[model samples]
Target: MPANPQAYRPETALLDLGDTFWDPVDAADFPATTLRFRNDAAAAEVGLDTLSDAEWTRHFGRFAPLPGTLPQPLALRYHGHQFRQYNPDIGDGRGFTFAPLRDGAGRLMDLGTKGSGQTPYSRFGDGRLTLKGGVREILATEMLEALHVPTSRTLSLIETGEDLVRGDEPSPTRSAVLVRLSHGHIRIGTFQRLAYHQDEAGMRALVGYVLRQLYGEDGDDPVRLLDLVVERTATLAARYMAAGFVHGVLNSDNINVTGESFDYGPWRFAPTWDPAFTAAYFDHAGLYAFGRQPEAIHWDVMQLAASLRLVAESDPLIETLQTFAPRYQAGIREAMFWRLGIRRFDDRRDHAVVQAVERVPRATDTPIDRFFFDWFGGHVPADYPDAFDELRRLLDPYTPRKDRDHPYWHGEPCSMLIDEVEAIWAPIAADDDWSRLHAKVAAIREMGAALA
Candidate 1:
């Protein structure tokens, strides 16, 4: 009922950077608005949970500006490498930053849209998103967050009265729009855009803006910025590996400057510990496969360094880039421990546990999440293979974070593999039933609390 929630803090930080970053745009006037999904939990973080369904639909579904947020949407501009190929023309073709605001913790966040409408970067295609695509993103973000992977949160999904034809899915699929909450939307390609044009001043200004707003730093040192980005990026890759997730696209545009994962497309969890597992059908080369995700992200980080080269010396950038490998390795070790619910010991012992964790799954073709679920807190299940003996011994000295008594750990571990995703979507597409989807989300949240 309140016009402005007491906890919400609207911000115009992105606008302060000026027009060099984005172009103001209007949201699409949809034929009909049908609210499909609402993330009340995420809304609560931003003090918008008290809104009635009508108010929520008005603000998100119809693109009505939040009370004190951006008066109009801004279609962001940036360029990225698409599967190792440089693409200078691509930007937010179908999405725009709708609101810039801070959460309850005062952390700067952006409410961005997908399938909103065409922009300068729309090119020849219609700016629309498939309903199934929006659903997939919701599942991806939920599972990743439950697994403790840093990622964007799906805020809302609304069905627009239109059918879309796509090459990937069955034609005449339902269309919808998605809103996501992210720490920041500045991608590495954002810098690449400035570098491609040889715009040193824009690069400097962007760097300063990123530091001040996202990281809370005040300096414009690109090298130092690159270092921080590399650390977060490597850790993100490590966490993805730990969670058995393959982000089908690791292009420069998809890699956020803040290192938080966003823009979920064709993402999947590996059913088994197979290195060659890939999520996207179009990825013939497996460049972004499950095991090679670390490499792909590292390559992206290199490209980020190359973009910073326009303003800073290359030697220090290269040196900072070198730290990515060790940080990634250490990150993997830490992530493995976290998943296993074990307190980390020294590197030698921790490395042994990680090696055993990695080896046992591949050797036995074990389900990734199930393996962690069964062996959580180092309690080796009766069915655990003898190959896990080494890991069990390594886990002995470390303290366990949780016992197997939690109800969530009692049955089959919740997984979001491709087949399960299709099962969850089948009813929604055929009969418009969303019960399974809702139930799955509740189960995942329970898993997250158990893990926490």
Candidate 2:
């Protein structure tokens, strides 16, 4: 007999950390709850796919508590540097951690909401999510996951019957509530808040809780933890570079302690290999531009190290921070080679390949996605530019893994360019036509499978 979906376990691990890290809040009373999109595949992993539409809406849309999980939604507290400026005023303003569950593999994961309601951190703005924004998030997560980025999975998106006015995009837009599943909601900012308040005990407690709940480890060694976080962040940065994804907001608070990418806003994929390609228009200085993502991520990791000083020695934490550069370089080398389907020969050849990857795309003005698609599995084109001679030579020894057999590779490469994004959203905005959205997601998944 098939196992019952409700048999999956729920966890209250975050609650044991105490109320200092969060505030209890009630979900907003929305005018209507219409399920816009449901990730049944993700639900199946967590044994929630068996729920009826009304049950799913009640749990995710209406924020009903799961048994033995979150008795109430929690607006988590933390401080972050927004655009490099220290800001103690930020937290989960319009969202909260709803509950935690164990997947089929018995790994702990969290279900958090965006634009669910207002909390103490809501600031002066009304707590609501524009439906367009939610749709964009769906697109971002789907594409990023297809590209193998360790990211939060979009579990559900429910359209709430309300009109929201926003500065960006068209005004009087529809609203929504988005649920995402990630390792856990705890962020680097969670540690920053404790460090800011000089709460050493709180820092220790937080570290212990994170090691147990998030990492599934017993020790709370901040130095060891920082090292692991640095490694993961390095890998994340490298993956973003290989995928040509610009996160737009690398704010310290936006980074999770688990090193997974979340909080999609003003994100964009590079059309070309231009280093200055930026996502958010407000990034006047290009602080979080495509090329500077590694720097931005490293800077956030440094702040995390600073936070760990409350419980660990500075020398050891600093030592861990130094590893970010080398680890990031290695990560980039591995990611690029994997995406290109080339086998690493030696240090020199790998270094040359990485340099060629950086140089060829920029010099050729090739769309980053097209470049990867064309050169996949070392299948260098016969008419390749003279500048690519060294790269082609380096790839000569490797056999092509992807012989362009995948249907997706036989045609145009799948990409998430800005204009394409606008085109996809236009029909949805005009007539609520989600057909294009569904089709695009299917295509992206096909591309992912091909790349894999």
Candidate 3:
């Protein structure tokens, strides 16, 4: 019943392409109110977000007036390797891609919502998401942005006047749907679904669609597409390691085929260097651990490759996958150096920084949060001999004391390291002092120029 339809395209480009289940229009059945609204600069780039509220509800939302904007209601279909085992019945269980929209910066982004109630894929479950889930996602996205990691931004959160049940927590809990602006919603499982169905044409069509939508400038070579995906994914993995982030659920269904970070469930920043740190309660085996992220990324990429084989199996695709390890390592190293605040890595200084921080015996299992917070305030200990001496002093109380030999204190310092680094980088992280840092770096460059 909306007059304009073109305005919704920016929001419709990212919808799942499989099945559509229409929501019946009755104000009582689907009473909605906007709780929060966010501007997704990433999504805006894709020529989306032009739709009016009525148009948005009509095309993306179920309860609408005339013929729906989208030709049909669609849910994405995909399979995934959950915790290293194949799970075929997983797709968008509680969420769906609405459409893509261009933001202020003109970047095309997916405007998708989580907890927007059920579809055929709901699988006899109450298709609702908790407010806590929405809160966690917002925090994770904000933190990732501050830490310079590429992630989806929370655009809006709408509390639907409904109660739903979930297996993890109490039932009859309040529910809210979250709209996130992301690069693309195409997941690795999407390809797998087509492969499992032996739909080569569909696979090819999907691949072509992704290439045009995300990497149109790269031309139409499927091998090139494979190479780019591997490179981007490898870089993303390295960034994750550098930031001490562990994506608890790295199932194929969760891995965005566009190589963007998607599905923020049970994700956490490391407190220590434990290769086995996991955020998901169900991940008893720690398949998506801190140290194993790179390998896990490779495994996911391989799954994508396998799916691609349904269309074309070639040496080039295999070769592209093989390049993942080296690229991943390089990306990790670069990201680590950046986080450590060492403009250039001098083996001596880098080791000294690492050792000095590691040696400051932690006194408690106190989180690394305070140390960084104090350091960002330019506070260091007088006892320590470094630029961050004041910060070290501030961190001393939290440092593990020799008398405190609890398990909590043992590996806590490693966790503190990231916080400490973030503290040192906070000025830059805040970006308010970038001009000054830039000027200082420039002055140093000038000194080198005079020396030369």
Q: Is candidate 1 or candidate 2 better by lDDT?
A: 1
Candidate 1 lDDT over residue span 88-166, tens digit each = 9998999999888889778899999999989999998788999999999999999999998999999999999888989
Flag regions of model 1 displaced more than 4 Å: 1-4
RMSD of each: 1.1, 1.7, 11.3
Model 2's alpha-carbon lDDT is: 0.89
Q: What TM-score fits each model?
A: 0.98, 0.97, 0.70
Clashing pairs in 2: none
Highest lDDT: which candidate?
1
State the lDDT of candidate 3 residue by residue for 1-452, as single tens digits: 33334433433444433332123212223455445333333334443345465444443345332333334334566778877788777767777655555544545566566776666567876666775576557656655655556788776555565766777866665556777778877788878878888986677677777887776543456677788789889988987875668888888778886678877877778774556778778888788887788888899999888878777767778998899988875666555444533343455444444444433423333233333322321234354335445335433333221222223222222232334333433463344243432343333233222212
Answer with 1 or 2, whichever has the higher TM-score: 1
| CA lDDT for candidate 3 | 0.59
Report the number of clashing residue pairs per model: 0, 0, 39
Ranked candidates, highest TM-score first: 1, 2, 3
- Model 2 regions lying over 4 Å from their true place: 1-7, 401-403
